[model samples]
Target chain A: MKSRNLPLNKRGFNFEMIMWIFTRLSALAMYTLLLIGFIGALLMGAREQMNFADVMRWAFMPNPSHVINTNIPDIAPWTALFWQLVASALLLVATAHGVHGLVVIADDYIVTSNGRKIVRLISMLMMASTSLIGLYILWTF
Target chain B: MGITRNVGLMTALRYKGQGPMLTFVLHRLGGMGMAVFIAIHMLSSFLGGKGGQFVNAIYEHWSFQLVIFFFVLFHAINGLRITIIDLLPKLLEYQREAIWVEWLVFIPVYGFAVFVIVSTALGSGG
Candidate 1:
């Protein structure tokens, strides 16, 4: 009796399965994070009476006008530190999900075993280095 | 099925087929593009933080920033759409509809970003 072969993506609670699950969950998290960042930015801009154009201009070229003029208290140092930590966490999750997603994509298109291996290796290296660099930058801030 | 799976430059341009299938391809492409941008972003942030000339040179290019923004926006929006369809299994029955809804949401949000980015860039004499 011959047995059927399972697809590489579905290996029954194996590495691929875990990575697949991580990608989905991370994507959901990323959606929330990205939304928060965008909304927060827009709100900040609005409070400063800056339109989207002004906000974007400020992004490209920071000026005194971009500074918060509201009577609201300034954010504490710890709050800034907390946000940096959040950003770092986002970086790690996004990189892992994106790298694995790309590898799986490469797997779908790349027929040869060697080609897939090469792609996965390169992706892993890139993911690791980028995450490290991003974390380093975040901590410095 | 008739679409040949050949390896070539053109292979990258060809879609596997229409609608949902195309969406899947685009999502993956967007993911890859975002991943690349994130990597570059890490390096750029590091350099820019140190006031490196390389970072300023790259940041000066509006086109690069535009592409990055577009890719990330698409990925985030489409990703949410995908999450919705996955979490609500019943929505699978309306996969086609879901995809259409995804695009409907995507276009306006993306268009707004483009308008802001382009208008600002051009207005700033970039």
Candidate 2:
């Protein structure tokens, strides 16, 4: 069989390709964070202290406020800086992954190049604001 | 460049592309649905008062739980299947089988989650 190699520039290094890879990695990252949160909650006695929905809320964000209303005696472990960082990372990753997805879907209906650019720009702005708001709540609350 | 025409919702729904098409459409819808839910959740948490609680109340409803869980579970599983196929091109030939497998995995897990959600709601008199 004959083999041909493409030029270096033709390789998949474009913005879209990077985002494609990012979406996959972010999904994996989220699963990891959720697992860590779930295990940590169980270690904290979530099986007895929290209901399924509350445990899910805690696992999804790992912020102390999410579990304050629960029967957990002490919130100190969950209030640790590590979980805050985890929540922050989740916020950023999920926001970027989701907004990029919206942009990709928008491209299907938006045929014009300019329209795509505008949509991308707006998506970026939305992602940024959402992340900022989420991080603020995660860190301060 | 090829000309593009607007696709009406009814027209798009009437198309008969079958299984793959249904999965593709559901995947897009699921992704969008989750994104919207995330936005609402973040904003509500940020509001942090009666206003926030008001928004939270809506999603806390059992019906909302069913819809959101469906989106999250389906999108996550279908996404994993797509990623596996993408990484291992040999699996591309098994796309239909992959989707069938996806549904096989999806139905039971989703059904169990739904059962739990409903039972919890009813148990709590929701």
lDDT of 2 by residue, A1-141 (tens): 233377747886788888888888888888888889989899989999987766766887788987887789998988999999988987888888899999989888787878887998899789889989988888786
Model 1 misplaced stretches (Cα beyond 4 Å): A1-11, A39-46, A49-79, B1-16, B47-52
Query: How large is the interface RMSD of each prediction?
Result: 6.7, 3.0
Candidate 2 structure, TM-score to reference: 0.88
Task: State residue B11's C-alpha deviation in candidate 2, in Å.
Answer: 5.3
Deviation (Å) of A27 in candidate 1 = 1.1
Best by DockQ: 2
How far residue B87's Cα lies from its native spot in candidate 1, in Å, is 2.5
How far residue A42's Cα lies from its native spot in candidate 1, in Å, is: 5.4
Docking class of 1: acceptable
Q: Number of backbone collisions per candidate, in order?
A: 0, 0
Q: Provide the interface RMSD of candidate 1 in angstroms, 1 decimal place.
A: 6.7
